[model samples]
Target: MQGYKKETELLTKLLLEILPILKAQYNLEEYQSKDFRTGDIACMKSLLSRLKHLKTSKFFSTASSDEDLKLKLKVDAYEKTAKNDQKVIAILKNKEKGLEQRIRELEKANKEAVALKKSMERKDEKLREVMRYNTVLKAKLEC
Candidate 1:
């Protein structure tokens, strides 16, 4: 009777440990709906294939080890940081493009301003010449 009791206790402990892992592995929240589309079926198949691969992978075997778990956590952290860095890079590229466009617009405006200033200078010179001619004509008339 004591032997049977010990076996039952061991079995109970094993089940307690295994049940949560199974629940996590087979989480079906996404597939709870009755309405199944073709895409959903394809996605389910893909997920099953990945699960099978994961079960056979070395990562799964090492998951129970403390050192491997710590390494996995570090890898996850680095991956998150990499994603944030990529987002920042994308934002900076957009800002650079905007600044470049603004520079081009300013350059065009500068060109137009220079051309207008040259035209005004030519008009001023022509006005001075006309005034001098008028003065000469007035002096001759007086003579």
Candidate 2:
């Protein structure tokens, strides 16, 4: 009986030491109630079983595998593609700016052409009036 009690005490001590570490590593929440006793063998056994399961599962392994490396390579490739796309967008924006400036220049030239055409039309009308007046005066002199 004494030996069994000693074993129980030792188990409790071990559990106290390991529990904090496991909780920190796995981001685990406290499973026991606030009023729960600290040295319950059942609780310690349950925790030990959980730890064993975690060790046997892939969740505990930190070593990078081939799959992880492949994923990293894919991420790098995608980043490169994103950079190239951004460059293309920047180039297109510059072209758009150039086109806008060209449009403005063409519009200004069109306005100037229209103004010149109107001025020429007015001058032609004045010339026709002068020719008609000259013809009338020549006709009066002949008479």
Q: Give all candidate RMSDs, comma-separated.
A: 10.4, 14.6
Worst 10 residues of 1 by lDDT: 31-40
Instruction: Residues 1-143, candidate 1: write the lDDT tens digits.
Output: 89965654553443333333433444634432221222244544554465557656665556765445445545655676789899999999999999999999999999999999999999999999999999999999999
Model 1: which residue pairs collide? none
The residue-by-residue lDDT of candidate 2 on 1-143, one tens digit each, is 99998887766655554444445455556545321245566766677677667656564454265345335445545676789899999999999999999999999999999999999999999999999999999999999
What TM-score fits each model?
0.54, 0.52
Off by over 4 Å in 2: 1-63
Candidate 2 to truth, TM: 0.52
Model 1 residue runs over 4 Å out of place are 1-62
Q: In every candidate, how many clashes are there?
A: 0, 0
How much lDDT does each candidate structure score? 0.62, 0.67
